[model samples]
Target: MKVGLYFGTFNPIHTGHLIIANHMAEYSGLDQIWMVVTPHNPLKKKSTLLEDHHRLQMVFLATEDYPKLKPSDVEFRLPQPNYTVNTLAHLQEKFPTHEFSLIMGEDNLNSLHKWKNYDVLLQNHHIYVYPRISTDKLNPEFENHPKIHMIDAPVVEISSTFIRNGVKEGKNVQPLLPHKVWQYIEHNLFYKK
Candidate 1:
């Protein structure tokens, strides 16, 4: 089986995420899109992140209805400050039968060279990059990578940061998330200030 690893903090999984994953599954050769819930992304700030377990649960709840979409806690057992290349190496070892690809945004691709062992990543795996708002300025080096492909993933300006801020301000986020996910957030009072 071919799988696309869509790694993120998922502070609270929302509809925008589901749409993208569904689109990837439907339009690409990938059979599944695993939501790799990272405990702490090495490149991102940790202070604003919710608890890893909580984030994972939200992802699970949001994606439970989609067979092609799965929520993975693979990084939980791995060492903290999770790095994509390390996770990919571990996953390939554990599931040798499956082919894995990286699903990322153009923003990440632009700075990917700075990531740990990025050359190894470029050589060993396929990358499915989605266009982001300001990726015209990508570093020239990225264009030469062997396994890079771009897909026109739908653009939704809403972000986890925006949703978190909405909750902090006691605003309704019903439109930002799916019905079940929004209910879960409300029931748990997530992001309440």
Candidate 2:
């Protein structure tokens, strides 16, 4: 099986995420797209994040209807500040029958050189890049890499940060998130200042 891993905190999984995953599975060669719930992203600040479990639950709620999209808790058991290369290595070891590909936005691509062990990641793994505003393509470090595939999906600028801010300001997030997820967020009062 060919699985595309779309790793993120997913503090509250939104419609934009679902749309992108659906598009990838429908159009791309990937058999599955796992929305890997990162316990903690090394590159991001932790102060604004909700509990990891809550984030994972939101991801579960948002993606439950899509068979091709899975909410992965792989990073929950791994060491803190999860690194892409480390998770990929562990996933490959555990699921040797499957081929795992990295799914990321163009913004991440521009900063590919800064990721931990990025060299190994580019050399060994396949990457699927989706366009994001204000971000350029991957630099020459991956220029010769045959495994990289670029995709153009509809860019919805809705982010977890925006959702959180909306909730905090008591704004309606019904349009941004799935119904169940929005209910969960409101019930728990997550991100409310």
Candidate 3:
């Protein structure tokens, strides 16, 4: 089986996230797109993030209806400030029979060289990059790489930051979130200021 790891904090899984996952699964030639909920992204601040378990649950709620999309808590048990290389290595070791690829936005491609062991990652796995608004074109070094597959997945402008800010202002973000996920967030009063 081939899987595309869609890694994110998913402070609250919203419709945009689901749409991208669906697009990747349908067009990326991958059997599954796993939403790997990172406990802590090394490059991101942890202050604005919701509790790990709460974020994980929100992802579960958002992806429940999609058969090809799965919510993964693989990073929860790993060390804090989870690194992509480490996670991929662990996953490959644990599931040797399965092939793993990475699903990310073109924006991330610009910073690929900064990631730990990025060269190794590029060599070992396929990378599916979806277009993002305002993102520059892929760097020349990786523009025509065989392991890099550029995809034209639908790009939604909505982001978790947008949802969080709206929720903090006591605005309804139901339209931006999955039905069950929004209900859970409202009931739990998450992101409420």
Candidate 1 local lDDT, 68-163, one digit each (tens): 999999999888766788899999999999999999888989889899998999889999888778836878887856688788889756799999
All candidates' lDDT scores? 0.87, 0.87, 0.90
Clashes of each: 0, 0, 0
* Residue-pair clash count for candidate 1: 0
Per-candidate RMSD vs. true structure? 2.0, 2.0, 1.6
TM-score: model 3 vs. ground truth = 0.95
* Runs of candidate 3 exceeding 4 Å displacement: 41-45
Instruction: Work out the TM-score per prediction.
Output: 0.93, 0.92, 0.95
Residue-level lDDT of model 2, residues 70-135, one tens digit each, is 999998889866688999999999999999999998888878889999989988889998778874
Global CA lDDT of candidate 3, please?
0.90
TM-score of 1: 0.93
